[model samples]
Target: EAQIMAEPSGNELASAAAKGDLVQLTNLLQKNVNVNAQNGFGRTALQVMKLGNPEIARRLLMSGANPNLKDSTGFAVIHDVARAGFLDTLQTLLEFHADVNIEDAEGNLPLHLAAQEGHVRVVEFLLRRTPTMGNKTLPRARSPLPYFGVRG
Candidate 1:
């Protein structure tokens, strides 16, 4: 059985991303660290990108990081990108075939994140790319209010 090494913490990777320290991250990856690992709060490097670091996110994605990997809370990279309204990052992820409809533990999809965050442009782009996007269990609403309750 392949031993699953403990995933790296989100905060560590997030900090590296925030500093745009690609070298350190590259070394860590070479050391077999989990690039998509999550932190104590269930936030992965991709999720931390939602806080504003498109360039780093792009680098990580290019380094074979799994865009579909979820944090402990089940939040996918697409969800974080959508929430952050990072159109460029979102597009890049899509180009890599990231799952657009992946949901969190609460069943909130990327559309839900875009809508809830009031990222109209992001939502529009995602909709144009994925017309059939949605969570069947959740009500179909154009706005994300239904998912996050009021734009945030």
Candidate 2:
């Protein structure tokens, strides 16, 4: 009856990821549950991984999760990683080819989120990898500010 166990729902997957339960997650994936399945908030396992578990995120990405998939707010997993200052998670996402310049609805990139959160190390890492990222203006800037923070 093992095969008859109920398939993990989207909420289950989200919870497993949130709890960093790699074993359960792997089992669900092996059962062919949708890795990209979103919870009620349209958040995939990858997004939840950004909250705490880079290892889980890594496994999801390796299993072919779409790194660029956006949540309800147009925030991708990279956006979450950047905002939280999860440098290792960000690096793993980058290794999976997560778009460095992906913009949210407001035209804010991961760099913008990192800057807004005052993640200096994240910002420096992003700048080192994508120098042009800093030059881009935020959503409604009347003049080019070269950054997202409030000007002095």
Using lDDT as the measure, the top candidate is 2
Error of 2 at 95 (Å): 0.6
Candidate 1's residue-wise lDDT over 83-150, tens digit each? 88889888888877798878788877788778777898998898787665553544445445454455
Question: How would you encode candidate 2's per-residue C-alpha lDDT over 1-152 as one tens digit per residue?
Answer: 34577877788888888898999888888878888998887888888763657789888988889999999878888888898998988898999999888888887778778877788888888867766654664355422234445452
Q: Give the C-alpha lDDT of model 1.
A: 0.71
**TM-score of every model?**
0.69, 0.83
**Whose TM-score is greatest here?**
2
- Global lDDT for candidate 2? 0.80
